[model samples]
Target: MKPVNKNDRLLVHVEDLTHDGAGVAKVEGYPLFIHGALPGEDVHIHVLKTLKSYGFAKLLEIENASPFRVEAPCPVFDTCGGCQIQHLSYEGQMTFKRKLVRDAITRIGKLPDVPVHPVKGMENPWRYRNKSQIPFGMEDGRVVAGFYQPRSHQIADTDICIIQTPEADSIMAGIKHKLTEMGIEPYEEETHRGQLRHVVVRKARATGEIMVVLVTKKKKFPQAAEALKLIQELVPETVSIVQNVNPEKTNVIFGDETITLWGKDVIEDQIGDVRFEISARSFYQINPEQTEVLYGQALEYANLTGNETVIDAYCGIGTISLFLAQRAKFVMGVEIVPPAIEDAKRNAELNGLSNTLFEAGPAEQVIPRWYKEGKKADVLVVDPPRKGCDEQLLQTILKQRPERVVYVSCNPATLARDLRILEDGGYRTQEVQPVDMFPQSTHCEAVAWLQLAE
Candidate 1:
C-alpha cells in the first residue's frame, strides 16, 4: 500500500536535507521531498506527485520550525532559481555543506578513516559574486531581466539581487530600464525574435574593473552608438563593453563572434600576487577572495620545497599553476581549451614567472606526452570541473605516480568516486577540506590531499 496519494495532506517531520536544498521526510518508509522545508522541522505537506520509490510534496505549513531557519533576505528568494538554502542561517549552511562532503567521502569513497574538516567560510558571505549572467526577456509587453523561475524559463523580474555584487545589481537595473526606454525588444525564446538575449557583468574584486557583455540575437545592434553611450553613463566603472552575436535559436549564452563595442577588449584582475587579464569569455573564478583561499590551501597541501616540479591538470588561466610556480622550481599546466592556454601563457608573462609552461590539450594526453619527453612531476594538482577528473587522467596519475596529489573538486560525489579510484591505485587519502565557495546555495568546493603509500 502506498503511503501517499495525490492531494493527500499529511503532517511529517523533516529528518534531512537533499543536495538541492529539499527537505526529506519519510512516511511509512516512503520518501517525500519538499522544498523550503529544513531539517528538524515539523511540516504539513500536500502530496503533489508520487513515484514508485519516492514522492513529491508541496509545503503547506510549518508546524514547527528549525532553529537554523532564518528569514531570507532576497525578496524573490522563494521563486528565483538563483539560490537555494537562503532560508537557512549561514552557520547552518556551512555545517550542511561540511556534512555533504563528509557523507559522500564516507559512503561513496568508502574512506571512513579520512578526516573531513569543517568548511572554511567567509567572514561576510553576502554579495561576494564578482560575475552575473542575467537573461533578458519580455513579459506582458515589458522588458524583464532577472533569474528564471524554478524549473522554468519564465524570468522572475527583480531590481536587486543580494548575492550578486553591488555593481552588477546597479548595471542590471540600469541596462534593463535603458533597453525598455529605448524600445529595444527583449529576446523571446518562443518566437526567436527580438535583439537582446542576455547581459553578463564581471567586476574585478581587487581592481574594481568592470566588463559588460551584451549577448544579442544578431550582429547589428540598433543605435549602437547611443546604446554604448547609455551603458557607459549607467556604469561609469565599466572598462569593457562587448557584444556577442548568436543568431541560432539555442539556449547557449555565447556565440562565435565577439566584438568590442567600447573600451579595452579585456579587463585586469588580481588573485593573490598574480595579476591576470580576463577577456569576456575567460574562465575566472566568481568568488575571488575564496579562490585565493582555495588556491592557498592547495599550495599548502603541495608542500613544495622550492626544488620539486609540479603539474597542474585542468589548469584554467594558470590560476593554480601560477600560484604553485611561485614556490616550486617549475610548474606545468595542461588545459583542453586553447584560449585558456593562451590566457594562461599571457598571465604567466604578466607575472614574470618564467618557470611555468602551459600547453593546450587534454590533461590525460598532454601529461603523458610530457613524461615521454623526460619530464615528470613530483607534485600533481588537479582542479577539475563538477564532473571531476577524467578517467584517463586518473589512469595517467596512477601510471606516473606523483609523490603528492592535490585534488580540488566542485562536486563531492564525483570527487569521492575519483578519490576511491586513486586510493585503490596505491594512493592513501590523507584528509579533505571543504570550502564554502557558493554561500546561500547548496553547492560546495573541496580540496583533498593524497600521498603515494610507502
Candidate 2:
C-alpha cells in the first residue's frame, strides 16, 4: 500500500457510512473516513490525518454523486453542528438508519438472524424538534445565541434553526436581541463572569404552549423584568419564562437554582391521551410527534393484554409507563432522577392514571428491592440511555425472567450489545423496529421485542 499523509489528495469510492454519518472509503483495504461523501459515490478527498488503522479525509469534489443525495436547505448546514446527513434525502436517511441498526446487530451483537424491520420515518421530516437549547455568546460586540460548532465551544450564530419549532427559534432570537439591547452581558466561559449562559426553549406541540429558560451565571439578572416583557411581547405563545442559575464554573447548562420569572414553572404537553408537565430541567424528548410513534411501537411490541403487570425501567416522566398503563393491569416505573419521578407522578395524576406507580432511584437497585417485595413484572420494558442498560440491571432482568422484554433504544450499537446478552440468557430476539425520532440527523430510535425461549 502506498504511504498516505496529511494534505495528500486522492480519489476514492465511498463504500459505507460510519455511526456518525461519515462516509468510508478504502485504499488497499485501509479504511478512510470522509465527511460529506455518501455511499456509492466517487469523490476526491484531501487526507486530513492518517492513522495506523484508519485515516480521516475531507471531501473535496464529488466526481459521481449518489441519486439519494439532496441539497441541505439550512444556510449554515456546513458550519452548524446541530445536524449531520441533512444533505442526504429523507428517504435515504431512513434507509441508512435501518441499515445502521441491522449492521450493528449483525456485527456487534452477532445476531445475524434477527429480523430488523424497515425504519418508520416521518411524512414531513422537517421542523420536528420541540426543544431548543442554544448557548449565549458575544460576537462582534453583540449577543448571539445558537448551537455550538462541530466539536468546538464556538457558537454558530444563527437567527433560525430548521429542525426546531418556529416559535422556539423566534423566541430565542427575540430574547437574545432584547437582552443585548438591555446590556445583559453574555456569559464568558473563560472567566465565568457574564450573566447569561444559555437559553432553552420548549414548546408543547399539542397545546401550543411555550417555556423559555434563561440560564445565567448568577442568580441576579440585570433588567430581568424588561427582558421577560420583551420576550413575552415578541412571542405570544410563550406561557412560561424561567431563570436557571448556574453559578459554578462548569459546562453543565442547568444549575441547582431554578426561579420562575413569570407564569408557571411547568408547561403541559400530551402524547396520545396521556398528558405531561415539562419543566426547565425535565428530560422530555425533543420530538413529540415521533415520540408518539416510538412509544406506540413499544406498546405494540409489549402486546399488553390488559391483565399483565409491566415494569418500565428508565421511564422518564412516565411517558411510556402511562402508555403501557392504558392497556396493562398495572405499570411501575423507576428512574434515577428524583425530579423526573416528581414530574412523572404529576403527569400520571394529570392524566388520571392510577394504575401506574413511579419510584425515584437507580433501576438496578430499585428493581431488586421491588422483586423482594413481591412485585413481579409480566413484561419488562426498558428505555435506557445511549450507554445502554447497566450490567446489574441486565442480570436482574435475566434472573427475574419476565415473559416478554421490550427494549426501546436510542443507540443501535448499545442496543445490539444488550440484546446479545439477553439472547444468551434464553430470550429469543423477535423483531426490531427502527424509528426516525431525530430527522435530518444520524441518531435513530428503535423498539425490539424479545420473548422467553421455550
Estimated TM-score for each candidate: 0.99, 0.98
Q: Candidate 1 has what TM-score?
A: 0.99
Against the reference, the lDDT scores of all candidates come to 0.93, 0.92
Error of 1 at 63 (Å): 1.3
What digit string (tens of lDDT, one per residue) describes model 1 on residues 397-426? 999999999999999999999999999999
Clashing pairs in 1: none
Question: Can you write out model 2's per-residue Cα lDDT over 156-271, one digit (the tens) per residue?
Answer: 88899999988878877887777766878899888887898988989999999999998988887768888788888878888999999999998888999999999988999989
Clash pairs detected, candidate 2:
none
lDDT accuracy of residue 27 in candidate 1 = 97
